[model samples]
Target: MTRAALVTGGNRGIGRAIAAGLVARGVKVTITARDRAEGAEAAEALGCDWALADLLESDSLRQFDGAPFDILVNNAGILPSGSLLDNPQGYFDCMAVMVDGPFRLTLALAPGMIARGYGRIVNLSSGWGAFAEGLGGPNGYGIAKAALNAQTLALSQELPGNVKINAMCPGWVRTRMGGPGANTSPEDAADTAIWLATLPADGPTGGFVRRRRRIDW
Candidate 1:
């Protein structure tokens, strides 16, 4: 069977790389972006489908209703420069994208995946989300990802069959958010996501990983 995958914020960066990698493996990939033109351009370049969906806008997610994606990558995120004291809305926005958006999408898609008896859910988490690591990042970025990580752990228990869900830290990749000084490339950062996306029935679920190795939550 041809597998179908959905990747959010896949117009560029690690999300784009992961979409391309999945396309290479013959998976039917659909990428979402806030910008329609950029999303279409990337879809054309990657030879996959595209959609306009903003993580912050809950209504925009209606487009994905009933879509039975075998793999789902919740990769869209934002990093505003401010502490909670300075900008509370920025914190909420981060939660909307990094936490709430993924939660909504997962709920929408998981039912179909359950019926199919297979699924792979990968949330683009970060080391900043790890409590043992001090949760030190931008104001809401770390908090939102930590919430996402918690969601991953909670959801894993509910999913049935061969379906698996996990969170991944892509490291400091050179992207719009990561800046030019970051060490990892988008392709390199996508490696672990791709691995988790294609895991077997016995693979680990509800875990955090980086570079294909398990890491602390």
Candidate 2:
């Protein structure tokens, strides 16, 4: 049977590349973006589908109806600037997008995935989130990603045998957040996410991976 997949923040950059890769693999892909025009344009470019979803708002999440997706790539995120003392609102937005949205979306989709006895969930996490790696990003960014990693681990245990969940650090990719000086390309960073989204039943779960190799989280 053909697989259906959903990618968040897929209007551009790494998310867009992952969506394109999934579409190339014959998965029926749906991407979520806050802007309708941009989302539609990206969807058209990828030859996939698009939905309006803003991860920052609970109401926006409630409006999304993308269940029945066999694979889910929670790639939507933001890099909140400033230190802990400076960016309270940015911190809130970061947590909303990186942690709360994925948590709720996973809760919503996991049931269908469990019932179908098949699923792959990939959370785009960061090395900055890892305790072993010293939680290196901006104030809210690392904390949110750490929570996301925890979410991945927790869900992996709760999910059924055939279903798998994992977190991955896409590395420093040349995306809007990553900046022009970043070393990795969008397509290169997308590789691990695409791999995680299409993992076999036997693939490792509850793990943090970079370039498809397991890493400390």
Candidate 3:
């Protein structure tokens, strides 16, 4: 059977690249974007389905209820500028999107995956989230990603069957969020995520990886 994949924030940047790559590999891909126009355009360009979802709102995710995707890419994120102390709402917003949203969606979809006996989950984490790396970056960004990584690890232990979940750092890609000077291309940044999303049953789970290599947690 053809695998189905859902990539959040896939209207552009790394998410879009990941969605495109999955479609190229014959996976039936669905992309979610906050903007209807952008989402529709990107879906048309990639020849995949699109959904309007706001990660901060739980009600918006109900649209995905019946479609239990085989692969879930939690790639939507925000890099709000300011210190965490001064920007409490920003921190909450970051956590909502990067941690809570993915957590809820995973819980919603995992049962179907378990019943089907196969699933793949990839959270687009970042090196900045690493404790060894000092959790550096825009205030809430690293903290939220760290939480996301933790969720990936914890969920992997609970999930059964061929379901494999992993967190990946796509590096600093030259996207709107990463700005124009970042070193990696969107395609290059999306590589490890694509790999994780297509892993075999024996593949490693609950690991943090970059460039197909393990990274410190």
Pull out the clashing pairs in model 2. none
Residues 3-84 of candidate 2 have per-residue lDDT tens digits of: 9998999999999999999999999999999999999999999999998999987788775454788888999999877987
Candidate with the greatest lDDT versus the true structure: 1
Which residues of candidate 2, in runs, are more than 4 Å off?
none
| Candidate structures ordered by lDDT, highest first | 1, 3, 2
lDDT (CA) per prediction = 0.94, 0.91, 0.92
> Better model by lDDT, 1 or 2?
1
Worst 10 residues of 3 by lDDT: 60-69
- In candidate 3, how many Å is residue 18 off? 0.2
Ranking by TM-score: 1, 3, 2
Which ranges of candidate 1 are over 4 A from the true structure? none
Deviating ranges (above 4 Å) for candidate 3: none
Error of 1 at 113 (Å): 0.5
Error of 3 at 127 (Å): 0.7
Q: Cα deviation of 97 in candidate 3 (Å)?
A: 0.5
In model 2, the Cα lDDT at residue 50 comes to 92
Better candidate by lDDT, 2 or 3: 3
lDDT of 1: 0.94
